[model samples]
Target: MPDNMALIEERLKLYMINLWSRSYYMGTLGNMSKEVVERYIANQRTTKSNADHLSKENSALRH
Candidate 1:
Protein backbone atom coordinates (compact mmCIF):
# COMPACT_ATOMS: atom_id res chain seq x y z
CA MET A 1 0.00 0.00 0.00
CA PRO A 2 2.83 2.38 0.84
CA ASP A 3 4.56 1.55 -2.42
CA ASN A 4 1.39 2.11 -4.37
CA MET A 5 0.89 5.52 -2.75
CA ALA A 6 4.45 6.48 -3.54
CA LEU A 7 4.06 5.39 -7.14
CA ILE A 8 0.86 7.42 -7.47
CA GLU A 9 2.51 10.51 -6.01
CA GLU A 10 5.51 10.14 -8.27
CA ARG A 11 3.41 9.74 -11.37
CA LEU A 12 1.22 12.67 -10.33
CA LYS A 13 4.25 14.91 -9.83
CA LEU A 14 5.64 13.87 -13.19
CA TYR A 15 2.37 14.58 -14.89
CA MET A 16 2.09 17.99 -13.18
CA ILE A 17 5.56 18.92 -14.41
CA ASN A 18 4.71 17.81 -17.92
CA LEU A 19 1.24 19.23 -18.36
CA TRP A 20 1.84 19.60 -22.10
CA SER A 21 1.92 15.80 -22.37
CA ARG A 22 -1.54 15.09 -21.05
CA SER A 23 -1.87 11.95 -23.15
CA TYR A 24 1.04 10.41 -21.25
CA TYR A 25 -0.60 11.14 -17.93
CA MET A 26 -3.92 9.69 -19.09
CA GLY A 27 -2.18 6.60 -20.43
CA THR A 28 -0.29 6.06 -17.19
CA LEU A 29 -3.44 6.51 -15.14
CA GLY A 30 -5.35 4.14 -17.44
CA ASN A 31 -2.82 1.41 -16.70
CA MET A 32 -3.62 1.60 -13.00
CA SER A 33 -6.45 -0.46 -11.55
CA LYS A 34 -9.80 1.29 -11.36
CA GLU A 35 -9.72 1.41 -7.57
CA VAL A 36 -6.27 2.94 -7.50
CA VAL A 37 -7.18 5.49 -10.13
CA GLU A 38 -10.27 6.49 -8.21
CA ARG A 39 -8.28 6.85 -5.02
CA TYR A 40 -5.74 9.02 -6.79
CA ILE A 41 -8.42 11.29 -8.15
CA ALA A 42 -10.06 11.55 -4.76
CA ASN A 43 -6.76 12.39 -3.11
CA GLN A 44 -6.08 15.13 -5.66
CA ARG A 45 -9.51 16.68 -5.18
CA THR A 46 -9.25 16.46 -1.42
CA THR A 47 -5.83 18.05 -1.42
CA LYS A 48 -6.96 20.90 -3.62
CA SER A 49 -10.05 21.45 -1.54
CA ASN A 50 -8.03 21.52 1.64
CA ALA A 51 -5.57 23.99 0.15
CA ASP A 52 -8.32 26.27 -1.00
CA HIS A 53 -10.02 26.17 2.36
CA LEU A 54 -6.80 26.94 4.14
CA SER A 55 -6.11 29.86 1.83
CA LYS A 56 -9.55 31.27 2.51
CA GLU A 57 -9.11 30.87 6.24
CA ASN A 58 -5.79 32.65 6.10
CA SER A 59 -7.26 35.48 4.10
CA ALA A 60 -10.09 35.87 6.57
CA LEU A 61 -7.66 35.96 9.45
CA ARG A 62 -5.63 38.68 7.74
CA HIS A 63 -8.64 40.89 7.11
Candidate 2:
Protein backbone atom coordinates (compact mmCIF):
# COMPACT_ATOMS: atom_id res chain seq x y z
CA MET A 1 0.00 0.00 0.00
CA PRO A 2 2.77 2.41 0.83
CA ASP A 3 4.58 1.57 -2.38
CA ASN A 4 1.42 2.09 -4.35
CA MET A 5 0.91 5.46 -2.72
CA ALA A 6 4.43 6.47 -3.59
CA LEU A 7 3.93 5.44 -7.20
CA ILE A 8 0.70 7.37 -7.35
CA GLU A 9 2.33 10.46 -5.97
CA GLU A 10 5.14 10.25 -8.45
CA ARG A 11 2.78 9.78 -11.34
CA LEU A 12 0.63 12.66 -10.16
CA LYS A 13 3.66 14.91 -10.03
CA LEU A 14 4.64 13.92 -13.54
CA TYR A 15 1.12 14.45 -14.80
CA MET A 16 0.93 17.89 -13.26
CA ILE A 17 4.27 18.86 -14.73
CA ASN A 18 3.26 17.65 -18.16
CA LEU A 19 -0.07 19.43 -17.95
CA TRP A 20 1.48 22.70 -16.84
CA SER A 21 4.23 22.57 -19.45
CA ARG A 22 1.80 21.81 -22.24
CA SER A 23 -0.49 24.61 -21.19
CA TYR A 24 2.35 27.06 -20.84
CA TYR A 25 3.99 26.17 -24.12
CA MET A 26 0.85 25.72 -26.17
CA GLY A 27 -0.66 28.97 -24.97
CA THR A 28 2.04 31.13 -26.59
CA LEU A 29 2.58 28.84 -29.57
CA GLY A 30 1.26 31.48 -31.94
CA ASN A 31 3.54 34.25 -30.75
CA MET A 32 6.31 31.82 -30.10
CA SER A 33 6.14 30.57 -33.66
CA LYS A 34 6.69 34.10 -34.92
CA GLU A 35 9.75 34.68 -32.75
CA VAL A 36 10.81 31.09 -33.32
CA VAL A 37 10.60 31.39 -37.08
CA GLU A 38 12.92 34.36 -37.03
CA ARG A 39 15.69 32.04 -36.01
CA TYR A 40 15.20 29.94 -39.11
CA ILE A 41 15.12 32.90 -41.43
CA ALA A 42 18.88 33.28 -41.33
CA ASN A 43 20.66 36.59 -40.61
CA GLN A 44 17.33 38.10 -39.75
CA ARG A 45 17.72 38.22 -36.00
CA THR A 46 20.39 38.42 -33.31
CA THR A 47 21.37 34.75 -33.55
CA LYS A 48 22.76 35.03 -37.04
CA SER A 49 23.07 31.98 -39.35
CA ASN A 50 20.38 29.38 -39.77
CA ALA A 51 21.34 26.28 -37.88
CA ASP A 52 19.58 23.67 -35.85
CA HIS A 53 20.14 23.86 -32.13
CA LEU A 54 18.49 22.69 -28.96
CA SER A 55 17.01 25.61 -27.06
CA LYS A 56 15.15 25.97 -23.79
CA GLU A 57 13.01 29.12 -23.73
CA ASN A 58 11.20 29.99 -20.55
CA SER A 59 10.39 33.69 -20.94
CA ALA A 60 9.27 34.13 -17.32
CA LEU A 61 5.77 32.92 -18.13
CA ARG A 62 3.72 35.32 -20.23
CA HIS A 63 0.51 34.18 -18.62
Model 2 alpha-carbon miss at residue 1, Å: 0.4
Which pairs of residues collide in model 1?
none
Q: What lDDT does each candidate get? A: 0.84, 0.56
TM-score, structure 1 vs. true: 0.55
Per-residue lDDT, model 1, residue 34, is 78
After superposing candidate 1 on the true structure, give the runs of residues whose Cα lies further than 4 Å from its correct spot.
1-25
Per-model TM-score on C-alpha atoms: 0.55, 0.34
lDDT, candidate 2, 2-55, per-residue tens: 999999999999998877642234454465566565554444443532222213
For all candidates, the clash counts are: 0, 0
Estimate, for each residue in 1-63, the C-alpha lDDT of model 1 and write its tens digit. 999999999999999897775233668555678788878888988999999999999999999
